[model samples]
Target chain A: MLHLVLFLVFGAICVAGAINLLVQSHPISSALSLVVVMASLAVEYLLLGAEFVAAVQVIVYAGAVMVLFVFVIMLLNAGVEERTKGSRVALILGIPGVLAGGLLVAWVLIERTGTATVGLGALPGFPKTIGNLLFHDFLLPFEVTSVLVLIAIMGAVVLASRPEPKNPEKES
Target chain B: MLSLPIFLVASVVKIVLVIFILLTAVAYTVWLERKVVGHMQNRWGPSRVGPFGLLQPLADGVKFLLKEDLTPPHVYRPLFIAAPMIAVICALTSISVIPFGTAIPVAGHIIPLQITDLNIGLLVILGVTSIGVYGVALAGWSSNSKYSLLGGLRASAQMVSYEICLGLSLVGVLIVSGSFSLQQIVESQRGYFWGFIPKWNIFYGCQFVAFFIYLMAAYAETNRIPFDLPEAETELVAGYHTEYSAMKFAMFFMAEYANMITVACLATILFLGGGNGPLFGPPLLRLILPTFYFVAKVFVFLFTYIWVRGTLPRFRYDQLMAFGWKFLFPLAIANLVVTALVVAYRS
Candidate 1:
């Protein structure tokens, strides 16, 4: 009963935060709302017994990922993006666009997910079990993902490391 | 879970106790740091407050509380308020998983010396502390001053860099202990290998390299001396909290000390065989002594923190980044590989 209550509360917060993430005008506000969304999701993960996933979700997604976003926003001196008036044609199409988009998403979700309810504490995400699963059964996929990351790093370095122009003063 | 009310009662009680102890410890840590650094600088620090300035933290608290809390016109109001709360909350939340000692029978109930036990206890700490970076970052950005901006930038960057080293350094300990649960780690460290030498991770698993890296990373993570370029007085004038005053300023310091304590606790549990000591007495004494040993080890770390603050010079910004990325990162990786190989061979 208590778990159900916690799940509902955190679940509501997560949804509300996601909506806030979309609605906030300032980039910082959006970033903070996303962090809230991630955190509440982490709690939901914990209530589901996926403790390892919950921690990783917070550490990697909310902490590292969102911090970088905030850092870049600050570095770039981003304020609230300026609003532009939409054309009259878009105004006429806007209500239909929203309704159609919402219908499509709801349809896809309904088509994919079964009516089966996920039982609480059904899957305990103990670190030992996760380690075993990752290294033993999913080793190749994991190693491939790591290699992909390394390649991405190399690509970033190559892109960033352009030679200076002959006249540095002119470049400045 | 137990009967909902019982679980609530126990958890609430544990939370209150831990928070009380943690805040009190943070208070004394300020006193300890002042006295130690004062003596280092050839001064008698805070003797006016109470016996040896024992009540200095209390006096300081009163002063901060009584002072007028100010908000500059240029500063962002909501974020400025939220930042310190985030910092203090994240710092305190990690203590939920830190076990002080073995279980004891209290009022016919077997109570573990922790708020709650999670299988991913260590990971939980890492996750929670990782969130603390926001408090620093937001505090700086919201302050709407150049000094605060630069300080916040340096601080967030430094924290992000060292956090990798911090996490990597602990992987070696994780391998040796084969558990993320703090209680299990302590249990694994209970026995001695050579009858005299304790089977702590440092000695038995040869985790001294990881330990060193962890300590260095922790210093940066907490923005202490040598790693505290964010708050270099000569440079940023006080870093992220420069614009803050009164209790707001005190919150930042409180967060710092809390982080220090958390790191010290982790160091004890991971490297120093937390709460494990020579046991020659009765079971009751045995149970009580480990908590004492645990606290004593944490104190030593806190003392060393102050000692190093007095000794070392702050690293230049570029130097700090280079050291973390070029030096510590590679060292941590190397240590992890070697430890993995050794563990594999032994098994």
Candidate 2:
């Protein structure tokens, strides 16, 4: 009963925060709302017995990644986002389209899973368990993901760097 | 066995007790800082209010409570309010997992000195405290001042950078202890090697480099002197908290000291054999001695924090970043690798 209550509360927070993220004009407010969403999702993860994943979600996503987003927004001094002037038709249809997409995904998920029940404290979330699974069962995918991340980092550095002037005094 | 309600009551009592003690400790730490720093500068420090300013924290608390609480017109009001609360709450929460001593059997109930224990206690602490970085960053950003903005940016960057080394340094301890539960780690450090030396990680397991990295990163993590560019008073005009006043400012102050205490506690648990000590006499002594040792180790670390604050000059922004990335990161990684190899070979 307690678990169910916690799940419902956090789930409500997640939905509320996500909606706020969409509605808020200021980037910092949106970013903070997204953090709230992520934190609520982390609680849901914890409720599902994925403690390590929950911790990782908070530490990496909510803490580091969202902080980066906030930093960029602050550095750029981004105010309220100006509404795009592209097409009224796209804007008018986008809301209903998004709602339909969400319903379809939920329908598909429910249909596929049938009456699958999630039991609390059943799934193991120990680091050792995760380590074993990653190393033995999903080693290739893990290694590939890591390599992809490394490449992306290198690409970013390359794309962002500028060539230094041969004659420093000439530039000055 | 106790009923569910009884267990719940016990947990609440424990939580309240810990919070009360931690808050008191944080307040005293502030008082200690002023006195120690003053004495170092060749001045009479706080000798007026109740001998060595013991009542100073009370006075400050009342003053903060009664002072004009200002929310600057230009500031982001919600975030400015939330940030310090988040910082303080996160800082206090990390202490939940620290076992002050082994379980004591009293009144037909086994009461562990810790509030609660999770299998992944250490990770929980790291997660909670990592969230604290957001508090400092948000505080600075929400203040709507150039000083606060710069301080916030520097704070976030420094915290993010040093966090890498801090986590890496703990890999050595985790590898040696072969557990993520802090209680289990402390248990693994019990007893002595060769009858004299304590079986702490620093000496027995030879993790001096890891300890050093952890210590330095911790100093940076808690935003203490030398690494406290986030609040460089002369340079940034009180940094991220420039616009904050009254209880809001007090919240940030308490949060910092609480973070320092948590770091000191972790260092003791990970490397100084946490609350593990010899008991030569009675049963009460046995129960008390462990906690005594734990407090002593933490006090020593806190003293070092203050001592360093009095001695070292603050690092320049560029210099702090360079040192954290160029020096501490690689050194921590090397120490972890060496420890891993040693542990593996021995096993």
Candidate 3:
């Protein structure tokens, strides 16, 4: 009963934070709301007994990545007044988006209920299990992910370094 | 019905006890710092509050409480208010995993000194401590002041760099111990090393190097002098807390001291035989002695912190980054390799 209450509370917070991120006028407020969403997800992960993953979520998403986002926002001087106004067209289209998301969640719940089983055995040492899965089963995907990250880093550097174009005559 | 209510009350009492101890320790740490720095600088400090200025922290607490809380005109009010609370929460939460003493029997119930003993206790500590950087960074950014923002940036960079080394240094200890559980690690250090020295991390050859790196990295990670460029009063003018006032400012101060104690305690547990000493008496006495020994070791580290603060000058910003990246990073890698080889050969 307590777990159910806590889960619902956390899930509500996560949804509320996500909605706030989308609706908020300020980019900084959106970033702060995103942090709340990330932290709620981390708590959910913790409740699921994936402590290491939860820790990584908090450390990486909340600590490193959010700080980087805030850093860029501050550096770019992206103030609340500069935020792009929300379009009515997007709000109109969001009805379908929400419907699709709700249907997907419902399907997942139904599938989980249909496949429910009891008496699952304990897995191996958690770190070892995760390590083995990463190295053995998903080795190619893991390496590919690294390559993707490297590409993203290089792209960021290139974008950050590109010089502003001078006049047309100077270009010629 | 009775059992549920009893459980709730018991847990509440436990939480209260833990908070009380943590707050008291943080308060006394300030007193310890003043006394230690005073003696180091050959000057009397805080001699007016109580006997030997023992109540100085209480006085400071009252002053902070009574001071007018100020919010800068251009500051982000919500984030500014949230930052210090986040800092204090993260600072105090890490203590949940720390085993302060052996379980004591109270009215036929064995109550552990720690609040919660998770299996992955060390990781929890690391996770919580890493999150603490956000508070400092957020405080600086939300203040809308150049100095505060710079301090926050410096703190974030310093924390991120040192955290890598700090985590890497602990990899050696974790490798040998074969567990992330703090209680298990302490229990594993029960035996002797070559018949004399305790089987602590510091006693091991390469582990000693790792311990030293961990110590240095932890000091930097916690933003202590001489690595405290973020909070350097000479330059940054109180750094991230520059725009904060009253109880909010006090929260940051408390968080810093609390984090210092947490790091000191972790060092004592990891490198110093963690609540383990030579058996010189009966079972009860033996158990009690180790806790005392652990506290004494923590005091030593805390004193070293103050001594270093009084003696060493702050590092230049560039020098700090260079030292962390160029020196400590490579040194930690070398220590890990050496430890792995030693462990392999021993096996």
Candidate 4:
């Protein structure tokens, strides 16, 4: 009963935070709301017994990535008065996207309606289980993920380093 | 029915006790910092309030309580209020997993000193400490002041950069210890090396490098001196908390000291043979002694923080980043590789 109450409260907070982001006028306010969403997701992960994943979510998303977003927005001088109306084209396109997303979520929920359930028992030996899975079964995907991150870093550097055309007078 | 109610009441009491201990410790840490720094600088500090200025923190608390809680004129008010609260919460939450002493048996029930002891305890501590950066970053940004924003940005970058080193350095310890559980790590370090010296992480030769890197990275992670560019008073004007006032400002101060102690305790556990001592006594005495040893080790680290604050000047912001990324990052990676090689070869 307590778990159900806590889960609902957290779920509500996450949904409210997302809505707050959408309706908020300022980019900074939206970003702060996003932090709230990320934090509650972390709490949900903790409740699901994925403590390491929960920590990673908090550290990487809330601590590092969200801060980067806020820093960039601040640097761009985004403020309350700088709010702009949504483009008509985006508004029209977003309706279909939102509808599709809702349908997909509903389908997932429907598919999992009568799954086998594990009774509450001792928590599994997480370190040994995860280590075995990561090293033996998921090694290829793990290595590929590292390669992908490396490529992303290289791509960022390339994009950032492209030189602008020098003015002839300034060059001299 | 009676047992259930009694268990509930006892758990509630334990939670309250843990919180009270943490709050009191934070209060005294401020006083300790002042007295330590004063002594280091050849001056008497806080001698007026009461008994070597022991009550100075209480006086400061009252002052903060009485002061007008001001939000900056044009800041994001909701986030501004939430930021310090988040900081204090994250700071306090990490202490819940730390086992201060062995369990005591009462009414045929054993109650642990810690509030919760998850299997992945060390990871939880790391995760909680990492999230603390948000409190500093958000506080800086929400204030809508340039100084605060700059402080926030610097702090975020500094913490994120050092966290990489901190996490990597601990990989060596985790690999050697073969577990993420803090209790297991302590249990593994029971014996001696070379027939005398304790078999701590520092005594393991290669792990010594990792230990140093961990210590340095921890110093940066906590925003202590030489890495205190985030709060560099001369340049950033109190950094992230520049625009904060009253209890909101006090929250940041409290978080800083609490983080210092947290990092210190982590260091004690990771490298110093946590709760281990040379002389072994009876079971009850042995448990109490190790707890004392752990606290004593933490005090040394805390004193070192004060000593560094007095003796060393803050690093330039660019220098700090370069040292963390260009020097410590590669150093930690190399240490990991070397430790792995040594372990493999020995086995």
Candidate 5:
């Protein structure tokens, strides 16, 4: 009973934060709202018994990634976003389009899963279990993903670093 | 298993007790730092207050409370107000998962010294402390001053950089213990290796290198000397809290000391065989011995913190970043890989 209540509360917070992220005009406020969303999502993960994943979600997503996001926003000194005129076409089609897509996905999920309820913390989300799975079962994919990340990091370093100038300035 | 009511009551009591103790410790840590640093510099620190300046923190608290609460006109009001609270909250919250001692039976219920023991206790501390960056960052940005802005930016960058080293260093201990739970890690370090030397992670697993990395990373993380480029007094005035006054400034000060205490506690738990020491005398003494040992270890760590502060000069911005990335980062990686290889081979 307690788990369900807590889950609903955090789920509400997550959705509310997402909406706030979109609504906030200031870039910093939006970034902070996104952090709230990430944190609430972590709570949701905890409710589902994926303790390790939950911790990682907070550590990596809410903590590191969002810190970088806020850092960039602060460094850039971004101001409040200017209000832009809405496109007539988007206004006419966007709302209904989103509604229909959401309804379609909900219909499909309910049809397939049929009101089945999994008990809280039913899955083997222990760090040991996850480690075993990552190492033994999905080692290849994990290694490939890590390599992909490495390449991205290398690319960033290359892009960030200045190339040697044709003529160096003389030291005073 | 404890009944729901008993569990809830126990948890609340533990929370209250821990917070009270932690706040008191935070206050005293400030006193300790001043006294030690003053003595190091051949000066008497806060001697005018009660008995070796024992009442200094209380006097400071009252002064902060009575002083004018200043909010400059040209500042982001909401975040400016919220920033110190965020910093202090995250600082105090990380202490929740740290086990001070073994469980004690109370009215037929086993109550652990810690507030709660999450399976991912170490990660929780890491996550919460990581989140604490925002407090300093936002405080700087919202203050609408050049010094504050520079301080905030440096803090974010430095913390983000060193957090990697901090996390990496602990991975060695995690591998040795094979558990993320702090309690389990402490339990694993119980017995002596050579019957004389305690089988702490540093000695038993040959994690002295990791401990060194962790120490450096922690100093950086807590914005202590040599790594405190974010709040360099000579360059950025008072850094992130330059514009803050009264209670708000006090909150930031409390947060820094609280973080120091948390880091010291973590070091004790991870590397010093937390709360594990010789037990003697009556049954009651045995029950209290573990906590005593834990506090003593933490005191040593805290003293080292102040000692280093007194001895070392602050690092330049570029040098600080270089040291973290070029030196500590690769060293931590090397330590992790070698530790992993040894563990794998032995197993």
Candidate 6:
């Protein structure tokens, strides 16, 4: 009973934060709202008993990623976003498309799960369990994914580097 | 097993006690730092308030409360107010999971010294520490000052970079202990080698390299001397808290000391075999001695902090970043890999 109530409260907060992220005009405010969204999502993961996932969600996403987002926003000293007239193509297609996608997902979830309630902390909540699952059950896929991430990071570094000077000695 | 009502009440009581003790410790740490740093520089610090400045924190608290609270006209109001609260809150929150001593039996219930023992306690501390970056970042950005902005930017970057080293360093300990719970990690460190030296992670687990890495990374995380570029007085003019005045400023000060204490406590728990010491007296003393040992270890850690502050000059911004990323990061990773290999072999 307590878990359900807490879940609903945090779910409401998560959705509210997501909406606030979109609605806030100031870039910093929007970024902070996004952080709130990330934090609440971690709480939701905790409710589902993926404790390690929940902690990692907070540590990696809300903590590191959102911090970088806030850092960039601060460095750039971004101001309140100016409202612009709606782009015709986006206005025409985007809203309906998003609504349809959301409805489809909700319909599928409700149809498949049939409103069945899961007990609080029902899934494997221990780090050892998760570690075993990752290492023993899904080692190949995990390694591949990590390698993929490494490649992406290398690509980013390459892209972000400045090109060599045409005449380095002359410039010096 | 404790009844739910008893557990709740005990939790509340523990929470209150811990917060009070933590705040008192934070206050005295400030006095200790001043006294230590001043004596190192051949000066008497804060002696006017009380005997050897014992009541100095009380005076400072009252002064902060009585002083004019100023909010700069040009600042962003909401975040300017919220930043210090966030900073202090995150600083205080990590202490909840730290087990200070053995369980004490009272009124037919045995209560652990810790407030709550989440299995992922170490990760929770890391998570809280990560989130704490925002308090500094937002404070600087909202201050509408160039110094504050630069300070915030440096803080966020430095903290983010060092956090990897910090997390990786602790991974060595986590591997050695095979658990994330702080209490479990300490429990694993019990017993002695050769019936003399405690089998702490630093000695028996061969985690000295990791401890060194953790120490450096922790210094950076808490923004202490040699890594305190964020609030460098010479360049940033009090850095992120320049616009804050009175109690708001005090909050940031409190937050810094609190973080220092938290880092010290964590070091004791992870590397030093927390509260594991000899006991030879009555049952009451046995129960109390562990906590005394824990506090003594933490005090030594805190004294080391002040000692280092008195000794080392601040690191250059580039040097700090380069050291964290180039030096500590790889060292921590190497330590983790080596520790994992050894643990696997032993098992």
Report the number of the highest-TM-score candidate: 6
Residue-level lDDT of model 1, residues B200-264, one tens digit each, is: 99886659999999999999999999898888899788989999999999999999999999999
Give lDDT tens digits, candidate 1, residues A1-172: 9999999999999999999987888999999999999999999999998889899999999989999999999888898977677688898898899999999988887778856556886675888788888999899999999999999999999999988799988998
Model 1 regions lying over 4 Å from their true place: A87-113, A167-172, B1-6
lDDT of 5 by residue, B1-347 (tens): 78899999999999999999999999999999999999999998888889999999999999999999989999999999999999999999999999999899998888899998888999999999999999999999999899999999999999999999999999999999999999999999998987888989989555999999999999999999978887889988999999999999999999999999999999999999999988999988999999999999999999999999999999888999999999999999999999999999999
* CA displacement after TM-score superposition, residue A23 of candidate 6 (Å): 0.9
Evaluation by lDDT, superior candidate among 4 and 5: 5
lDDT per model vs. reference: 0.92, 0.90, 0.85, 0.83, 0.93, 0.93
lDDT of 4 at A104: 93
Task: Give the higher-TM-score candidate: 2 or 5.
Answer: 5
Between prediction 3 and prediction 4, the one with superior DockQ is 4
Report the lDDT tens digits of candidate 6 across residue range B1-347: 78999999999999999999999999999999999999999999889988999999999999999999989999999999999999999999999999999999988799999999999999999999899999999999999999999999999999999999999999988888989999999999999999999989999555999999999999999999989999999999988988899999999999999999999999999999999988878999999999999999999999999999999999999999889888988888888888989999999
Q: Each model's DockQ?
A: 0.84, 0.72, 0.53, 0.57, 0.84, 0.92
Which candidate gets the maximum DockQ versus the true structure? 6
Model 5 CA deviation exceeding 4 Å by range: A111-114, A167-172
RMSD of each: 2.0, 1.9, 3.7, 3.0, 1.9, 1.5
Tens-place lDDT digits, model 5, residues A1-172: 9999999999999999999999999999999999999999988888899888988999998888999998899899998899989899999999999999999999999999899856777766799999999999999999999999999999999999988776677532
Judged by DockQ cut-offs, is candidate 4 incorrect, acceptable, medium or high? medium
Of the pair 1 and 3, which is ahead by DockQ?
1
- What is the Å distance of residue B2 in model 3 from its true position? 15
Q: What is the TM-score of chain A alone in each candidate?
A: 0.82, 0.87, 0.77, 0.79, 0.88, 0.90
Chain A TM value for model 6: 0.90
> 1 or 3: which has the higher TM-score?
1
Q: Give the TM-score of candidate 6.
A: 0.97
Q: Which 10-residue window in model 6 chain B sums to the lowest lDDT?
A: B197-206
For model 4, state the Cα shift of residue B195 in Å. 2.6
Tell me the TM-score of each prediction against the true structure.
0.95, 0.96, 0.89, 0.91, 0.97, 0.97
Using TM-score as the measure, name the better of candidate 5 and candidate 6.
6
